[model samples]
Target: MPLGRLLLITVSLVASTGLASAQHDRADWDRQRARMVEAAIIEAGVTNQRVVSAMRATRRHEFVPLAQRRLAYQDMALPIGASQTISPPFVVAYMTEQLDPQPTDKVLEIGTGSGYQAAVLSPLVADVYTIEIVPSLGKRAAKTLSRLDYDNVHARVGDGYQGWPEAAPFDKIIVTCSPENPPPKLVEQLAEGGRMVIPLGERFQQNLCLMRKVNGELEREPLRATLFVPMTGAAEERREVLPDPERPAIVNGSFDEIADDEMEEPLPAGWHYLRQAEIDAKARPDDPAIAFKNDEPGLPSQALQGFPIDGRRVKRLRVGFAAKGEGIRFGQQASQWPYVVVSYYDERRVWLGDEVIGPLRGSFDWIERSEELPVPASAREAGLRIGLLGAVGKLWLDDVRIAPAGG
Candidate 1:
């Protein structure tokens, strides 16, 4: 063969191989993503057909950091810089399901982490107004959503606690971050009968709460347990002052009969009790490690424990304590109610299990054995640990207790 002809043939062969490889890469990415959507979204009952389809079509990998691209489809949260996280696929589906958005409804999102949720929301609603306090994340999310042709989403860099006042009356609002209480501005912005799903509590344990505006009143119901980073911005500094002390204490004796006058005493402070039967760590001497502290009411208790935490295996952490405050102050807004804060940790002090249950409102609530929180996959085999980060006010914690699975 002539030299020029032979060279051209070789070049053609290389180009063909390159093209095939690229095609395979693209096909594999699609297949993996589809499997994730099937397992995490569709199987989980995110029944909005349009939302499901859009989630399947959107490439989550593109929104995550390059180092975490491989785990984009995993049913776990991924860090997206600035200490923020792109929520797991299941959480996205779960929260979205709670919204129950309609085709013509306009939605608002409080955290635009990686823009993944907003991207998911964009195609499901007529418009999405999302706010992110982190300037860098907001900018990056905006760019990513725009590049993907999600024009229906308007991403802004600002305080989400303020909500988007200009776009008042959103049909639905979803807050990705947890706040001590639902932002008042958000409630004011909701259209009558519109729903809002927010994670309410301290930075540790949060309750997934759904609220509806009825007759100018915001009615709320606790849905499930969850944990998320605290919402940041000016709202964080906005303190709630107690109402007039002269007024009578508000008491509903129906749930449990405790005198309203008795409820006025500040809870006890700085006490930890361990059950004798559960003290096997004394034999092991170094097995289960524990730590505790006390803070004022409405503050979160910071505690740390380490030993062994089995996945999906239920355990109980009974925190017997009282707060030293005039009484549990329900926020001026109905949403700001005091709740219990719990954290599961591994040996390294990395936050693993975080659960917040609320506005038990100065009542004694025990975390049931069956309700043991799951430690994140990253920290599961590292040895069980727990901590009391902080609390609402000065409270006495006595009989600090823990019960492992089957114990």
Candidate 2:
């Protein structure tokens, strides 16, 4: 062959190989993302058509760090530096569903980590106003959203506790971080009949709650149990400094009353970080007894498990349990529905038992049966157990009733 012909053949082969490689990479990425959407958002009953469409359209990989792009679509939270987290897709979908946003509504998002949640909301609602306390994150998110053509989103750097007062009377408000309670300002900013979803608790564990304003009264409901970083900035400051007493303490006695050597530096209120192990030990049971009305099929299941329990109720359930492992399975059938498994260890760290139940996909009348299993001694003195719910057309579990056996 002539030298020119040989060179052209070599170049053609190299180009073909590169094209094939790129096609394979794109295919793999698409498959992984599709699985994530099916399992986390769709199966979980995130039925808002616009929300689902926006979630599918946005490329989450672009919002994460380059090193973490591979795991972007996984059904777990991802760290976005600054000790903040981009919430798991399932959580974002769950909270979005709870808000039940309408096409013309204006939504406010607190805690704009990486701007992923805000991005998801921008395409669903008429307008999205988001606030991030960290100046750097706020600036980065604003640029990212702008580049993505999210013209309806407005990003700002400020204390989230104060909310966006200038954009008051929002149709819906969502706080990504956990607060001790819903900030009064957020409630005041809500339009009449508007809803606000927030995680309420101390620094460690928090309860997912929804508050609706009606006739100048706030109606609160505990939806589920979840964990989130505490709402930082002004909210944290407000909690630390309570009003001073009417009078100061005056000890006129000798130095014996207050020995100079007995003094030690006081511990900072926010400095006591709970280790992951301690947090797991203090974690609440996943399944608590809850009751519901109009248990419908094909709709998302409701769990009253997060309500504030009185001392008596807490004692009754033997609330403490060590989680061995938890997994979820998805399905779509006339009755046999998708469900989750919550396995636990006893106080001694031995495998204890597990519970299984159907989630709300449709109506409740179709649900048939639910089950629980206990661990066997052969399995390291701790056995594996499961809760199985039989075929039901559409069933929802509310107010999970869990108590220590023989307690």
Candidate 3:
């Protein structure tokens, strides 16, 4: 064979192999994005079509570092460097939908950690002005957004508390980080009758609130209980809801403290997602209990609540709760069954591990269950999740409590 012709054939074969590999990678990413949208965004109940489309279109994997890209579409937040994280896919979708974005709207975003939120909003609105306090994160996010062709997102490294005064009167404003109170400047910059969705409250826990500038005053509506990194810069000066971390325990464990808003769903205070196990007010009339029912064996119904803890002082925890079950059976996985999980987290709020209580199968009238789990030496926070985890049948829980094991 002639040397020239042989070399040409080898080059062609190499190029074809590279092309095939790239195509496969692209296809895999597309499949993952689709699954995330259906399971984490749509099925989780974000109904806005535009929001859904934007979520579907955005390539989340591109926003994170290459090492973290593989886990980008898992419906959970991923670290994006500098003690920050990209908001979970559902959170990004839910907040965007709550803002009620419009094609002609001008949106302002505070805390552009990964710029992923601004990227999602870019196509949904006319413009997006985002601010980030951490210079490194802000610069990286700006570069990512630009490279991804999100031309409408304008990012700057600055304290978000003051907001972008030059671009006042934004049609919609979304704050990704939490503040003890809505930054006054942000509220002022919002256009009249404009909508704003922000998480406001304590340092550890907060309520995702939807606010409207109505007749020169803000009307606040609490959407759900959530946790977000605290807004830095000016917001750090205020310390209103700074509860003592040394004393960490469950609140409203008896499923009491119902919302008074007749227009909204009644969920136990300090908790969110009654859909997982809605409050059965009449089931135990005098003592309300949260109930979970899943006719479909493989679908899980769960609710989570986070509490501040100082693991250094509290080395072990005892979780106690009263639960009743009927026809409880495991789901597709053996690990999925009725149980209460106490998840511990490190100082950075990264999950360490979980101490789960029960597989509570079969039928039972009512019984009290308790278990003790050791806290990791580096743990600083804990979260409690209760429900039938991908299990079939009904489960009711009440009087849930977590305390230092010996105490």
Candidate 4:
């Protein structure tokens, strides 16, 4: 055989292999994307078909950093540089559904971190005007949007507090970052009866609020509790609650101070993080309990709270709670079970490790569970998560408490 012919055939084989590999990856991404939408979005209670369709159409992997693409379809947030993160898939779908976007509506998005949210909105709304305070993030997002041919999204770098005045009177608005209160300019720019979904409250504790402008005034409705990076620039200066560590201990762990709004999910106060879990509506008046039900068919339900602990002062801690499970089953992975995890974090909120209790399953009556965990030398805070991690079942919890082990 001629050497040149042999070389050409070898190159052709390599090209075909590369093409097959790329196609295989694309197929895997598509499967993950479908599962994400079904469990994280649909089962998580985002019912708006428009939002669901938009979420299905958008390619989240494209907006994420190259290193994080493999995790793009997961229901958690991933870093996208500039010390920022792309919002979780569930959050993006929830917020977009709250906005009630329409085909002819114009949307203004604040805190365009990775442009994923804008890209999701692009197909649902007529136009999307997004602003990012960070120059680097803004430029990269703009480039990604353009590259993806999200022609309807208009990206710019500026203070979101000022909003896009030239594109005033947006029919819908969504703020990704949390502000202590709604920005005045954004309020003014909203057309009458326009809807806006934003995270509003203190630094670590905030609520996802859905507001509507009516009669030149904003009517606020708290949707659920969430935590987001605080809005910078002017909103930052106006922030009233500075970051401060709370005393180490559980608050409202007995589920006594639960929100009683029948219109919304019953949530317990002091539990800053909640997902698919709520205060038991069926509990007796004298006995309140936190309820964890698998609304997401096969997905895990979680409700957790994080607090600061002085590692230098406190050495070991004891956590106690009573739980009951019904028709519970572990998930496909070993880590998925009905358990309570105490996750430790450093001063910068980097996770150190976790101490867990229970793989509780099957129909069981109330069982008292307790565990004592040593504090990491570098730990500054810890999180208490109570739920079925990746498992599906109904669980009830009560009398959760945390204190110094020997105290």
- How do all models score by TM-score? 0.59, 0.58, 0.93, 0.89
Residue 300 lDDT (model 3): 45
Q: Write the per-residue lDDT of candidate 3 for residues 1-407, one digit (tens) a residue.
A: 99999999999999999999999998999999998898778877899999999999999998977877889888766767766778889889999999999999999999999989999999999999999999999999999999998989999999999999998889999999999998999989999999999998887667889999998779999887777888989997875677665777787889887643532567677774334568888657598898899877656487778787787888888889998899999988887898898887776656688888887989998898888888888887777888997798999999999888888
Candidate 3 yields a Cα-based lDDT of 0.85
lDDT of 2 at 306: 14
Q: 248-288 in candidate 4: lDDT tens per residue? A: 67768898885436427768876754667777755645787
Worst 10 residues of 4 by lDDT: 241-250
lDDT of every predicted structure (CA atoms): 0.61, 0.59, 0.85, 0.85
Residue runs of model 3 more than 4 Å from their true location after superposition:
1-14, 65-68, 260-263, 273-275, 297-300
Ranking by TM-score: 3, 4, 1, 2
lDDT of 4: 0.85
Model 4, TM vs. native:
0.89
RMSD of 1: 15.8
Candidate 3 local Cα displacement, residue 155, angstroms:
0.8
Question: Candidate 2's error at 232, in angstroms?
Answer: 0.6
Model 2: lowest-lDDT 10 consecutive positions: 268-277
Comparing 3 and 4 by TM-score, which wins? 3
Q: What is the lDDT of residue 241 in candidate 4?
A: 68
Top TM-score prediction, candidate number:
3
Per-residue CA lDDT of candidate 1, range 251-308, in tens?
1101121112232221111111111101112221233212222333222233222233
Show model 4 residue runs off by greater than 4 Å. Answer: 249-251, 260-263, 270-276, 281-285, 295-297, 308-318, 344-352, 374-382, 403-407
